[model samples]
Target chain A: MVHNLWTELYIVLLLLAAVVIISQCYITYLFHKYEQAKIWKVIGILFPLGLNIYIYQIIKLEKRLNNFLQIASMERRDWRTAYLLVLAQYLLLFAVFGLFASP
Target chain B: MSKRSKARIIFFLYILVLLCFDTTYSFMIFNLFLAFAALELSFLLPLFRIRNNKEIVMSMFFVVTFILLSPNAIYVVTDLIHLTFFDFDFMEGLELKEWWNFTILVSGVFLALFYYVLMMDQVRAFLGRSKWMNLILLLMIILSSIGVYIGRFLRFHSIHIFTEPLTVVFQIVHSLDYSSVLFIGWMTILQIIICWLFLDEVGVKNGT
Candidate 1:
């Protein structure tokens, strides 16, 4: 019975991660459109496997955009709390999984 | 030398000492070393200015290699299952040799995790803390979790992806059951929590 509860919680956490990843992808798309970044770079952003490479290219463009447009970007701290909440949820998930998954 | 470089040197020395001390588990240390090397190469590859097609292709090759090997780092954690091989009985009291073996195994695991945390920090510093950066990290964790599942349960090494690509792919697809999903989910969450703890340490260190 306890194992079932942990499994349910694990599924919930996985669902939450999926939602965050999908929403972040959408946000990245919008950023690409607003910035009028290169189409290929944006396409590469959609491919999570090569994300680091594409991110490097997009960040270079963002630096140029920052200089030319003087647009303010979101502070890292703004996302810190949300990230912490996710981390706490996952840590709880890990603890439960560790406790119940072992014989 | 920079602080990061100093840390790398210290870590290397620690690995050497562990290698010398534990002959039976030297292969695990070697695996950890190779994984760390792949990560370092991947991190350094981006530093080179991409001038032409050849450079771009080479960089992509290293990126792929990095992804393939990254799972080995966390795969060491699963080595804890080998603890069952050792004798541990509270009623009989602790055995020094068994306890020593446990220490060596755990130290190697912790070193692997530290390598992972350091790599993440390096990537964050390179990309800057943005939504894109976080997304990339999430993708990496997800990929590594899948990779670990393949490595641990399916018994496929990273090189198998190159030599037996079709077979490896088929096995991975065939092995998609509830237990595999659960294992992958557990690994993903565990990694994220470790990364978060590292981030908190950086914040505290920087007085942010």
Candidate 2:
């Protein structure tokens, strides 16, 4: 019984995550349309993409071409790039449960 | 001196250590690891990539620990939040853990801007592959993913270490779905060869 409950919870959580991601993307898109908050446009757009890359830890970390991604021009470690991506990941995962718990 | 690489290495070490530590003690270790990850994150602060203000940092720590601890942790955070707000029922259905989670996420947007100050340029040198390194990278990815799956299974089964190794070995062989594994195995081999060619071309372009 407990196992089933936990599995159900896990599945619900994944669905919640999918909704939150899609919702956030929409809100970000709307903001982009409004011509408000220049800073958020870059972040609101790039953050999600950076995030999707980070959580994919199963994909071993080798060097991705920084210039290729347009994240940074140099081949060196893009500290800011890493943070934005990793942070987005954690936040998305964090907000997910709440999305499911509600209604 | 790329601290990023150093930080990555440290994070890798921490994960391995956490896996080896006794499960009961793992929470303490996990909180510590969360702190370490946060600290490593701080090195990026100067670049403004990761905003390091107090509220944001606390929220980050709280959320990281909250996730690391699991559901029962959900209650303790809720109770604490309730005590502080004096609203026993603030944000209905919002457990302390969930609320903390939301706060961290909401705050991240405001914090995203400080990231561009840091200059980056260390990566151009190593795109070419050693056939051996490619093989090792592939092996590590497979092993780590299996480790993750096994870790979850053991937690569910309530089984501890004496049997953990056995499960880990079983997981690697049985891990990926059969058809996908066959496809991925070949794909990975091809990737290594393509990567080698690309890196060689980049080298030639640079040498010009």
Runs of candidate 2 with Cα error greater than 4 angstroms are A1-16, A19-88, A95-103, B1-3, B21-24, B46-208
Q: Which stretches of candidate 1 lie over 4 Å from their true place?
A: A1-103, B1-3, B22-24, B48-54, B200-208
Interface CA RMSD of each prediction in angstroms? 12.8, 12.3
- Give the clashing pairs for model 1: none
Residue pairs of candidate 2 with colliding backbone atoms: A75-B122, A75-B123, A76-B121, A76-B122, A76-B123, B47-B118, B48-B114, B48-B115, B49-B115, B78-B96
Which numbered prediction scores highest in DockQ against the true structure?
2
TM-score of decoy 2: 0.26
Candidate 1 accuracy as TM-score: 0.60
DockQ for every prediction shown = 0.02, 0.05
C-alpha lDDT of residue B180 in model 2 = 45
Per-residue CA lDDT of model 2 for A13-92, tens digit only, reads 67556654654464345346533656555554555534433432213222333222223423223333344444544544
Best candidate, TM-score? 1
Reference-based lDDT, residue B65, model 2: 36
